[model samples]
Target: MNYGPLLFLGVFLTLASSWCGLVLIPQLQLWKSGGLEAVKLEKTGEFYPPMRSGLAEHGREVYRANGCIYCHSQQVRPKGFGGDFLRNWGQRRSVGRDYLRDKPVMLGTMRTGPDLTNISLRQPSASWHMLHLYNPQITSPGSIMPPFRFLFETRKIRRMRSPDALDLKPPFAPPPGYEVVPKPEAQLLVDYLLSLRAVTPLPETE
Candidate 1:
């Protein structure tokens, strides 16, 4: 009996099965279904209140320009997959609907820093984020993340320090007569970061 045909058929079938199971199936389920829901959300309105706003939209551009995706990721792995659960990044596995509105999905590869999928919920204060962006060390002492001091402006005080001025201490603080305020780009970027949170729960959890 000739085994050449049998061997070739077996290899082809195995490849076909793998492609269907791994690629085609997930594409149909995740992409097709999600694409539909995204359109429906636009037509019928969002299930949850709109979170991402104009400020966040502009801030996202600023975030991209700064290459934040290089160091920080915006995803959370499932409980069994990794330490994401232990790190308390999110209560549930991040789903497609969570980012349906995002035009340029930023599901970053590396986790050089903590996940930002739910950072807004964890740290809701705008002031805190401003301070952190100005100098990561102020919030996370000895942090490897470099300070974005260029995002801040040191201006001579005219009256009292602006309410938005950073309360940097000691070595990080501005000169005696100067105060540091986040630039417009920095403000927008922080707004975008503050908008990141898993507000819409999945049906499985509901």
Candidate 2:
């Protein structure tokens, strides 16, 4: 009795079953669940607000197109790794429940830039985000993040343009002659990015 054929058959069966159990089963569960809700923190604060699914969907497209996942990661590692735990990545360890709504979660594998799970709290200023998006080097002198100038418009205005001229709602549209304008997609992306704040409060030592 040759063992080679038996071994090959056994390995194939194991892989096939594992694939179905791990991949297909979980996908079916998600489909049946009609999307999962994000886990809420025990104590709420002025941190990350509830994410709009519509905005998140649009932002997902932006993330995919801009390849942000290539440089940034969404997952926070457990403490004990050199400076990572010391860094303000998150208040507590990230759990799967935190990303229940993320169909194809953006838990990237690289670390070209720091983790952005808690970026909103870390740098919540809209102006800071605008400048950084327009030109990464302006904020971080040595940053390697590419400038997303295409997402914004640069123009010189002698006088302020009416809110109706830009055809955008107030607040988002700059006052007349603002010099720079964020495209609709850029604004949406910014809104989505700003919404990525980690709402979980830091654990207190009892």
Candidate 3:
């Protein structure tokens, strides 16, 4: 009674079903439980609008296409030895509700680049982000971040366009010879990044 093939098929199917039932199914259920909707901040002191910009959506696509998740993460682990807990990065631990609006959570697995959960607070300057995106090596000489020059353009400073003048359509194209900037996408991404602040208040005990 050689049951080698049958046993292998049975084991594979069991593991596959178990993995999907336990992990994938639950995740899908969680996703379906709530769609993107704003929640009031507990602190309210530092409240800003949840990312509702068209650029944020475009930036999300850019984030996915670039595989930024492969290097950086969006989640801040529970406070501990992880770099995120360090004073230099942020002052609070992240919570599940903080990411309630995220459709596909970007809690990446790797840590090639520092966690970007608090980048907006850490380096709020738009110029800094632009320079970094244009040429990572220029800002941090040792940075492993690949340059995204293709996403931007360069030219001398000139007349500024009114905020109301921006087109909110997809495939956001900047005006000619105006140094089509990455910060347009970076700004929205930064906005979303900034929005990653944990709604949970910090514990009093050290």
Candidate 4:
């Protein structure tokens, strides 16, 4: 008795069930739960996961173009899994709806740097972000993250210094009579980084 057909049917059934359980079922559940839509807040009458601004949207492109995703991740692990809550990477566990507005969803796999899920809320200072981008060492001592100095330009100071100029000190600062200022791309990238916030509570994730 040839069991080739029977064996093939069994293997196919097993793979099909695995796919259904792993992928199809979760997708169906998400759709059914209305998890893809923007949630409405009863008090403010505003929606959660607010819409992305034009600058932040452009900044997101800059973030991707600069390959920041390779080192920094945007996902926060749940409790008992990786101690993400203890680390204060996020106020709550990340969920599908948290990424509904993200076009590519930068849930990076590597952890060369800290998770950036709630960076905006954690470090809301734009100047701090500017310095970190210009040179990680200035902000974070002994940081392995490379400086994106090319994003800025050293220009001779005219009548006065530009307000957007990086307030560098000592070796990080440029020579006298000159100041380092972030270009458009650098500002956009910082804007994108400053926009990364996922602290809102969701019914499913909470």
- Give Cα-based local distance difference scores for all models: 0.83, 0.69, 0.62, 0.90
Q: What is the TM-score of each candidate against the true structure?
A: 0.80, 0.72, 0.65, 0.88
Please estimate how well model 3 matches the true structure, expressed as its whole-model Cα lDDT: 0.62
lDDT of 3 by residue, 1-206 (tens): 47999999988999999899999987787567532234455676533235546666666777887788999887776667666676455566655555655667788998899888778777776566656776676668888898787666454446774432323122333445344445466656544544444434533212
- The TM-score-based order of candidates, best leading, equals 4, 1, 2, 3
Over the stretch 43-149, how does candidate 2's per-residue lDDT look in tens digits? 66432225556875687678778889999998777767645558978766565555765657889988899998878788887667777787777778789998887
lDDT of 1 by residue, 1-206 (tens): 47999989999999999999998997798875654253324445666425578999999999999999998899888878998888889888877667767778899988888899999989999988988888888888888888898999999999788988988889988889999998999999998998898745556334
Give the 10-residue window scoring lowest on summed lDDT in candidate 2.
162-171
CA RMSD per model (angstroms)? 4.9, 6.8, 7.5, 2.6
**Number of the top candidate by TM-score?**
4
Question: For candidate 4, lDDT tens digit of each residue in 6-112?
Answer: 98999999999999999999889888989878999777778988988889899999988888899999998887788798898987888888898998988999989
The lDDT leader among the candidates is 4
Better of 2 and 4 by lDDT: 4
Please give the clash total of every predicted structure, in order.
0, 3, 0, 0
Give the lDDT of residue 131 in candidate 4: 96
Q: Which sections of candidate 4 miss by over 4 Å?
A: 1-25
